[model samples]
Target chain A: MGVTVLQIFPDSSRSGCLETEKLHKRIMHLDAVQCGMFTVDCDTCYTVTQTGNNRKLHIVHNSETPTTTYAILDTGTKQITLSADYLFDLLLPRLDFMYQSKKNLKIESKGAKYEIGDFVVKIGTVTMSGHYKAILVEVEYLPCHTPALCWSLMREFMQSFMGSCVKPTLPSYLQNRLHDIHTPQDTVQQYVEKFNEIREGTTFAGTQTTGSGS
Target chain B: MAMPVNVPHVGENLEAAMKSQIVPDQEFLLQGSVLDTSLGVVIDRLRGLCDNADILPETFHDHEVVFVLKDFSAMSTPGPASQGVMLRVRRAMDYPDLPYQLRYVGYPELGNYPALLRNCLDIPVSNNVCEFLTELGAKLDHEFIAKGFIMKKGRIKVTVFKMYKMGIGMAKDNLEQMTMSHMVELSVLTTKTDMSVAEDLRALADQLKPLVQLERIDYRRLGP
Candidate 1:
């Protein structure tokens, strides 16, 4: 509904919970009222066809919008997004022959939500296949819709708790859409981008652990 | 058929509950096309035969795109084994702000029915649907513009429209006619439990009679 910025909080302690707690404490210090909880999950399905370039379909669901399903199709060249009713979930299984879902690749971010003045903040723990992976922090400015108009205020608010992790410029996703009115799709796209990064990061880490063990 | 006396189990009742909640998806359709020279006479005849003859018929301009989803592995097979599933996306060019429609029409039911009956589902989807279909591996088969008038008589909807070829870059203005005929479609959407609507659809098609001979048309039989 408003401009949202997603930032990947560094987990130097190698513990997802410890980093989440630190961020939680810092936000509580700002007198932010603890709202309920929120979640954003992504499921990846890859093309099984032998011909043509490989493609990925990312189906995302946000707890805030319970009845809506957002599907982002990642072709090798461009990405396409479709927002449909929850019934779209029922249609996925019928396409199993062509697009097979990777059950182990399911990723989700779940955490406490907070409201401080006009700003709503959520600190989520990213987990893949039930294993903790990283931390994702989302800040939304409820009063403004365009990032160009409210990026400065959001940057300062994010800095109050997130510190140096908050960048001076907008995220690359928001930069391209700075002048346009932000929609819920924009928020979900950011989640997909962050989820892809976290997915690749886990694979990279998996290789390192196996190499050392061998 | 006798009614069961015992209470139905949860699994048995689940299907009944779903049926009660969802709207009808079966459509009884009859189609015909009139030549461009006789289009005015057909419109005049439809106005006289349909309900509310005094009011002006509702006009619409829509663009339709057909996409087909097929498994490449099945391409090797012969015969009609792998006809693939087709989904049609339609948007009203006149009403740009309205949501686009995604439609799936099943093969006609084989029975001695009065009209053609098939499964149909129309869902309103977001704007970026074309890209979504392509990503789903549904190749674009063809697209065309339909300019028409719609009239309703009870549950039956009669639509008479002319197809136009989409110009380069999908230009709305300056279009070329795909044919010298105006296609007329008479249809009614009903539930699986109700087959009575097919008779009514047949009656409407008969009313148009010699003006436009509407009949059950199996497009697949016509060949590509």
Candidate 2:
């Protein structure tokens, strides 16, 4: 089944962004809870399996965490996340891994998540490696799998509080993969783009000193 | 044969029998889901089923944790149906003493009326047994909350349920229902070869009429 999700990005000036207090109050109207996590991607690999579908896996090894090492496997429609040790011990030894992400990004957020009627709303701040980047508000309408059918409803609900932060039309990611099921990979992909942007903005002092011969 | 009106009684050996059970019983089952914009039709059908059969007053509250396993050693089969194997562990909320069951279901194949001939074993396991599957390479899939209302009509087992998707981080209140539509499944489990059972299933399907459409759905064919 497809999930209808709309992501609201902060405005350029941040003036139109909903304040933290207001965000809480808006979410409180739906009676939500605080479900926040600090996720760090230690290693990532993207490869096409023999069945001809693109698959990606991420290994998270954060020391200061209650949970042990784990991995997230994305096959577009379905995202299977399990223990990193299990994947390494049983699965990883056999398959060939492809592209790997070098720079690891840490995202920590404390957001209020609640389901209003049939919709789930998440309003929180996204922090990358200790610096607060932007406020993210996600509204997911669970019932309808087809985005074309539920897009209007999702927009109206999001716009009630987020104002113009949310795009009037379907996001490009959802539009491009309109035929595919919206999995946790969609959310992870957004985080990865932001993480890459952060990585590109800063120059590594060590890499600069140790110049590449090529 | 006439349809039995009484509820199927649980025998004294029910516990002992389940403990020693090993072989997957060769049974024929035809099942489908009902997804309608207005749940009133399905709700009314469920009420009709309740009125016709000897249904228990108590409902089966199921908290199922599904684990999706990928075999890195072998190449995945070339179809959507053969994508991955799923291991489901189910526990009843009311019956904690009752032994939990761990079922491993292979990708269902399409056959006559899309007959899904798969191995379904009911193994008695501890509550924490899922940890063992994870140790063996199974990845954690999304969990869901299902509350089922079971009704028995003669040889048929009718189950109506409301399914909810668990949100990330495992918070109980953070659950989001998959859809407003309730799934209505009609099934019969018998060891003997009975092609006639299909006719019975079809009859039941016909009775539901326009209220609910009970057609075998190939999971692979589902788009998006």
Candidate 3:
């Protein structure tokens, strides 16, 4: 519905709680109103080798858009995204012969949501198979649809609370879609990209391994 | 007599509840075709036999893309080989704003029934369905354009359309006809518990008797 930017808040202490609390305090200091909670979960299904070449399918569901299901198919070469009604969930089990769901690979991010003026901030704790993985912060600028037009203003707003972790430039996902009208699918795309990164045990962007933090 | 009367009422209530929650997935179908030259006469006949005979039949131009997902390893297996599931994506060419349709039709049930019954699911999907299906390893089998009239009589849908081959780069203009006949299909979607609708489909097909003999033509029986 708007331009959404997903940033990975680094967990230097290796415990996710402290970083999330610190971010929460900074956001609350900005007179932001706590607005319930949010969640975005993804289920990965891999194509059976007997069917063809191996591929990955990511089925994502966002609490904000409860009635919709976003399916991103990674064909090893390119990614194709399909947004369908929530009823699409029923069709997944029928595709078992072609794509086998990796039950243990299920990942989700859930945390408190905040509203400040036209911006909505969500700080989610990413967990894979119930194990703490990382921290993800999602900021959505409601008034603007094009990331190209709102990137600067959003960066300033994000920097107010997220500090240096907020990048000066657009996320790579938004770079190609800077001028395009942003949709809910774009938001989920960012989540899938970050989820995949966290799954691979990679370092978060804009964070140093200080090794000592409360 | 008293017990039978009470049982029907209870069964009807349960059936209604189940219908409210589950979509009808069984499609009872009958197919036949009329020659291109006789298409006008058949359309005129349908206009009278179908519902709302006063209004003109709704003409449609749809593009259908067929995708197949097959397990390559199944060819070597000894048991009944997998025929591979086929998914069809259909969108109206005249109405581009309408959502694309994703259709899954299973093999016809083998029985002594008067109509063809098969498991079917039709989901209105986003425009990105083609790309998603391809990414799911469903190979593009073929595509064609179907232009014709669609009429409805109660729950039964009657469609008489002619298929055309796509031009270069999937161009719509200057298309070539696939056959000399206009394929006529009479279908009704019903639930698994109800096989009674098959008779309705048969009755509708019988009306087009002389002009176009609609029958339960088993596609698999028609050799490749």
Candidate 4:
């Protein structure tokens, strides 16, 4: 409802005689309104771009229609000419819709993991590229590794960006591993092994290569 | 880079006379804060007069931009401005220097108070643009009115005479364009969450950048 604009490529001319049959079909169904153009008024013309050359056939209808719709065809170069009506009516609505979807959009990529820090790890991929950005959430490979940095890294790494939805159900044993992983000399691996011994299917962070079945 | 200079559309030998006031080749902000509406338009119509003239830099900002009144009454919140300041403005007719106008209104308004005009000048032009508007108000019935000159190179003088006219055509053009545009493009680069609209518009003073020409004085404003 605001403004309409058009952007046209500078060139498009001729629909050769060889393509006469196709050209006849187009004109029979064109919305040729009565419109006189600028100083150089252009009528609908057919164009055929060959591999090495281009051709065209112009159909000049009588100036019988009211001067309402005119075509400003480019005779020289290839260009993108926008329909005036389409610019304001069609494009504006699209832009408004796009803008509506512009806030707090969320995304996710499951089963991914990330190297959170020097001594910590988490499951997820970087969703954004900013200092305070978060990461996409991920599934666990281990139940332990309760370092606060590990938790923070997990929080950040698990936020993948795309669409938006909210849910709250974190991994189990998180509190226990967080406590043990922060201990002075205890390797997080040893704690993870103990957790795994008790619960054989604890998913862990980081890429682990295994050869055969246990 | 230096801003270009152009002499006024009045008098001969005037450029040489003004050149003596300048330091051989230095740009100067040739201001016209007159309430004279018609006179301002005449000066404005000569938009790129300083295009080829040599204007050495007196200040850091480069590129000389001419200011024209989009609406004179816009300056006064009053009707029908004067032409004297615009005429006195052709000071470059005497000096070989670059020129710039801080306040620009098209027609139907000019400053009414003398004190308001004077106070406009003495203040610094860099930090406070509002002060620039006041100085735009400063020239009405001013001490600098009718005649002015630079007391440089120890009394080398360039005489400036003042006059005025009504700029109706220019005013109509400004207002009409304000009301209707052929087309206006919305910015496509907006992010999903941009809260900067209010700030940018505020900086624009609720006016389109097209309605007025506030020439950039600081050419080399450094990094963030």
Q: Whose TM-score is greatest here?
A: 3
lDDT of each: 0.82, 0.54, 0.83, 0.23
Question: Cα RMSDs of all predictions?
Answer: 8.2, 20.6, 8.1, 31.1
lDDT of 3 at B59: 90
Per-candidate TM-score, chain A? 0.93, 0.57, 0.94, 0.18
Docking class of 1: incorrect
Candidate 1's residue-wise lDDT over B32-92, tens digit each?
Answer: 9999899888888889889999998999999999998766555656532256677899999
Q: Classify candidate 3 by CAPRI docking class.
A: incorrect
In model 4, state the lDDT of residue A86: 10
Candidate ordering by TM-score (highest first): 3, 1, 2, 4
> Which segments of candidate 4 are over 4 A away from where they belong?
A1-214, B1-91, B101-224
Candidate 1 has which clashing residue pairs, if any? Answer: none
Query: Each model's DockQ?
Result: 0.16, 0.01, 0.16, 0.00
- Tell me which residue pairs clash in candidate 2: none
Of the two candidates 3 and 4, the one with more favorable lDDT, higher being better, is 3
TM-score of each: 0.76, 0.41, 0.82, 0.13
Could you tell me the interface RMSD of model 3?
Answer: 11.8
